[model samples]
Target: MNKARIAAAPSPAGLAFRLVFAAAAILLALLSLPQAGHAQGIVRGAQEGSYEGNRIAGPVGGAVGGVVGAGVGGAVGAVEGVLGIPHRHYRHRCHGYYDGYHRFHCYR
Candidate 1:
């Protein structure tokens, strides 16, 4: 006797289960983010600290640096939030040309 393999199609229940699982995973991930106003500061501080620490020392230093950086960053962020200080973005645009005398000038 010879047996032939048959292809099977995914069922609606399986599809629904996958979709629900994906949605739940995404929701949980989003909910896990820091909700504090200083979240950005903390994140940036940790990253910077870790990088510097790792560069200057080693793994241990990186861990310590991250903790210290996070604390400092959170404090700064809180202070700025309370002070109502707005983040500033500066754009500098200048056009310059060199003269025959090798003199450079910029005009705005």
Candidate 2:
């Protein structure tokens, strides 16, 4: 029974493989750090801008919009990071209306 158990146990090569696989997995996880806020913001902004521009105009407009959007997004992201403000989510609702002077008002 003991000999049978020993034969059934994993071989040294199998153990080495498992260790190498685990190490590789750990290394990959470590390498894939979360993107910075500004980077994410910029990417999102550029994509949105490009889409809108393409819908409204042509390729030239899309390019221009992408550049402008990226700049704005980067600035906003930087400010949010500095202020320690979390990213906004659509789940939150705000009640608002336009006032008499064409100014918008919001209440949460």
Candidate 3:
């Protein structure tokens, strides 16, 4: 056993593995996000603005609304998702100023 491995023994393999593993983990994590967002009621891509997609994302939204109201909700969910309606956007006003160069910054 030895001390100061960083200043003496920087294992390239270990460093490479760490970097590769971290990159892979981050990539996989990011790749799984969109699906998770959808599961969490995010209607992305094509189904962004469809009202039917709204039901699937609602508190009880599920494969139960047959595209409209209760029953065969899955197909409708798919169709609604494919409708590609633009999502509505609302504007809000906010103001902020930088706090410091070496500290956390927040906004309201």
Candidate 4:
């Protein structure tokens, strides 16, 4: 009777294949992250988050907005979700621009 070995070492080719697959998987995961994160930004922005990481207020007042709109807004707010709703002016009357500090500045 012959029995298969469950703890046998993998062949060089098999090991290489597994390593390549793992690397590819990791790379794809990393690459997809930014795209996914950008989508989230558009959402938080549409929801009246800061405009490009700026802490400016939205249609609602700053002191009144609280934790709801805590992300960047404006052009970043133009991104539509999977539902494809028009969010161009989701930030309301807010405008966005780069500040002298090389950071995004958004406000009414």
Candidate 5:
């Protein structure tokens, strides 16, 4: 059969079915994210806790503590990712970087 014949075979119902399935799949993926990130929430909660602690721990200590804590958390997560250590403590998003001529998001 020619391509046109194959293309014309399905009716509107088929098209609607495909669209609904696609949408449901997308919704499922989107809904799964927060549940997936519940582990990351622990790290985020810790970050907030330290931030609050810093306020009480004194200005100098707080600033130092917050920076060190966040940095260590991110770095440790990155290393664990490389080493295949299963964790969900932090979520990392890669924003595109720019050189004079280029921009890229490295996540994908």
Candidate 6:
């Protein structure tokens, strides 16, 4: 094997492979630097829940909504069960009464 000839003529495939690997490594490093600066730090409060390491209102709101929804759902289910109809079978309406007089608006 002649070292001079091998050194003088580098394979195109080898050159292309090195270039692609180098580019990928540099791209990854550049992408990660911004993320390091923008690092999310933990936040603590009287109302303490962490979202991305920071305190957020999501869990509290979700819990409240879940409890309220369950109550409403139970009420609706009970009403349906008593009426001998499935939950979807019932139609709903809204009415405003005036001076203790009942006004009915039909909605189907």
Give me the runs in candidate 3 sitting further than 4 Å from their true place: 1-8, 35-108
In angstroms, the error of model 5 at 65 is 2.2
Models ranked on lDDT: 1, 2, 5, 4, 3, 6
- Pick the winner on TM-score between candidates 2 and 3: 2
lDDT head-to-head 1 vs 3, winner: 1
Write down the TM-score of every candidate.
0.48, 0.49, 0.29, 0.38, 0.33, 0.29
Candidate RMSDs in order: 16.3, 11.7, 19.2, 12.9, 17.2, 17.0
* Segments in model 6 whose C-alpha atoms lie over 4 Å from true places: 1-57, 89-108
Supply every candidate's count of residue pairs whose N, Cα or C atoms clash at under 3 angstroms.
0, 0, 3, 7, 0, 0
Report the lDDT tens digits of candidate 4 across residue range 11-35: 8999899999999999998975444
Q: Which has the greatest lDDT?
A: 1
Mind sharing the TM-score for model 6? Answer: 0.29
The sequence of per-residue lDDT tens digits that candidate 5 reaches over residues 32-83 is 5444333453476457657876787877666666666766666665555546
Model 2: per-residue Cα lDDT over 7-64, one tens digit each: 5776899999999999999999987654564478789889988888878888988998
Q: Which ten residues in a row have the lowest lDDT in candidate 2?
A: 1-10
lDDT of 1 by residue, 62-98 (tens): 9998999999888787777667687686544567776
Off by over 4 Å in 4: 1-8, 35-64, 71-108
- Once fitted onto the true fold, the runs of candidate 2 whose alpha carbons sit more than 4 angstroms away are 1-35, 91-108
Model 6: lDDT of residue 22: 100
For residues 17-98, what per-residue lDDT tens digits would candidate 6 score against the true structure? 9999999999998965533212121112111222322333466654554555555545554554445564344344554333
RMSD, candidate 3, Å: 19.2
lDDT of 3 at 106: 42
- In angstroms, give how far residue 76 of model 4 lies from its true place: 9.1
Better of 2 and 6 by TM-score: 2
